[model samples]
Target: MRSGSASSEFSRGLIDRSGYASEKFAEGYDRHRLSPPPAVLKILTLVAQAERPRLVVDLGAGTGLSTRVWAGYAEQIVGIEANARMLKWARRVTQEPNIRYVQAFASNTGLCAGSADLVTCAQAFHWMEPAAVLREAGRILRSGGVFAAYDYDVPPAIHPEIDPAFAVHFAARRRARERLGLQAGSATWPKEQHLERIRESGLFCSAREIVCHGFQEVDAVRVTGLAESLGGPRTIFGEAAPEVEETFVHLREAAERVLANRSWPMVVSYRIRLGVK
Candidate 1:
């Protein structure tokens, strides 16, 4: 199990990582990441009809993947991100006429009060301060507006032969956390727990959930690209520290040996939870 002790310091460290010079991380993630499942649109549409959402705010919008999803539907779509590199990439790559980007933390976005008709966090609630962000969501959203969060549960690998590579990858992650002294201090928790946290916040009414599944294919190149784009975490933790890099390299070599020349299908399962203001 992952730790539940994630702290502000850790979050700050992530915010300071400053992404790659060429924005490789943002590009890779946008390319390989799962598409916004239908449930996200369904929920947004359901709420849009009731509130006639003119302004949609996507917190932790990262590379604008989630922000672009609302382009044609909303009169204006604003993507807020803490990381400058991510916002830069989002601004450069996504050219929607009605979509825009801003650099801001999820916990405290400097948006106008009651300006949003809908708020969303896609695969990013884990990194936020739940109570603070939820309170901020409530502050910015119009009365009776909607808030929704969703994340995909990626099962390392399904192919038996390739599973071993994933095993090594997971072990490396555990070791990396241990080396960083984050095992007991960092906890992303599970996606489902996020829903519970929302309910506990008491900021919204009638919170609900929807489970959606997406299918895709993965090869060595895709998997490696994902690790590279996200970070050297799964394959090779670049220049961070010797111990961390060792663990990453080990996993990379192991995966390299196993996935010499093969590809397999992957099932990406997503759980989307929605609530009303």
Candidate 2:
């Protein structure tokens, strides 16, 4: 595994720079690339019954992880992103003959009307204004097309005590933010309530939910990588700050301590919520 600073071309000191978080986040984003839930493919399989997608659009395609997942199914896939750095990063590392990245916000993709067979947003819907994004999705999707948005929250758990340990660890981070007079990041709409919002958008019919809970066995280093990769703590405290760097070490230590007592493999559990259109 490469160290976080392996890409010296991208400065480690600029994580909070305005309008460039994605680029800043892009530097180390691949080091902690996300794995979507198994249900994601299952949902897409259901969508295949309607018609195997021809053109797919991936909104907020950070580093193109989810976009790559769609590549095999679609002849053409476009990844839309608001951040230039992230777009460049995705194009560089996730390039496929069928995949391309465009600079655009989720709310206004500038795509031709009814051009897409499917739309996907993963781990990024919370960063958007869902109503506007849904409206835009409604515009670009063909009549029978599907729009799916999904996210997984909370650090990967290493069994019974890891989640509790992480709660305490992050709460302390929040308190530190309070001490600095920096506001904590607000919670995004809960997965349950978001269903109602999706239904009310009047975009597409038959709104549905797919929930997945799974665990991955990991070590202390993997835990630390996951912690450092999240943009929240890095953006809030600034990754270059000594305190923020210290928190990563401490978070890893906390995980190690919590998992030592369990004979079971150190497992990180994640819950994924997928909203279908």
Candidate 3:
């Protein structure tokens, strides 16, 4: 495994500087952000079921959305996040007794070595430096402990009528990233490559992807909220773009029009990778 210093430097640049925009988007992150697809929940449930971990550490645990689910099965759940505002909301919103929230970066959790039964990062793995995080996670876990990383793969289509608009939404996001000087990469964000690196690091006894699916019914209001939570259209527009808002409003209105006469379901795909040390 790579030394903590090496991982820390890489992660600090990737997360603290390059990924800083994410923190700005956190306030509105939950609103338009799609829920964890069913596949991810199932995998998480399976991990909790199989491990029945006494102590679980949730890395990059934004707002405790994933941690809340694990809290039921794990004897104790510790959520570590770097963003203070998000951590505050996570602490405020989750009332689970077994769950504790900490403001800390995933690259360096500060927890003692060999103390955790399981370590999981949901939807936030791309934001981390895998080599560093994997090393730290391995150090913090007892023998036979598990480390899991999971994220959703948004399908190409949202809805027949709204599909084009969703395309525009993504286009706007790409433009936003470009404006911020971020490089464009594949949709998967080096996931497979990172998994290979983790395997090569020899920190895990085994590692593989867990497949899962999710379905949800999104109304206009909920969709609007989700968009807002994701940095409010402003993140994409730089300044509020009336045209983008109009597009989202139109999409919502179209959804309403469809729902008034029929039922529509949105399906999401997810991949969860689990590594056991």
- Estimate, for each residue in 54-112, the C-alpha lDDT of model 1 and write its tens digit: 89999878888888877767789889887766778788888889998877777667789
TM-score of each: 0.77, 0.76, 0.79
User: How well does model 1 score by local distance difference test?
Assistant: 0.68
What would the TM-score be for candidate 3 when compared with the true structure? 0.79
**Which digits, one per residue and each the tens of the lDDT, describe model 2 over residues 55-119?**
88988787787888776667889898766677788888875799988877777777899888778
Q: Candidate 3 residues 205-237, lDDT tens each?
A: 888777777777766565445544432335435
Report model 2's TM-score to 2 decimal places: 0.76
Q: Give stretches of model 1 more than 4 Å off.
A: 1-10, 17-23, 47-52, 156-160, 182-190, 217-219, 228-265
Native-to-model Cα distance after best TM-score fit, residue 235 in candidate 2, in Å:
6.6
Ranking by TM-score: 3, 1, 2
In order, what lDDT does every prediction score? 0.68, 0.63, 0.66
Which segments of model 2 are wrong by more than 4 Å?
1-24, 47-51, 173-192, 214-217, 233-235, 238-247, 256-277
Candidate 1 clash pair list: 3-187
User: Which candidate has the top score in TM-score?
Assistant: 3
Clashing pairs in 2: 157-268, 157-269
**What's the distance in Å from true for residue 40, model 3?**
3.4
- Ranked by lDDT, the better of candidates 1 and 2 is 1
| Displacement of the residue 209 alpha carbon in candidate 3, Å | 1.3
Clashing pairs counted in every model: 1, 2, 11
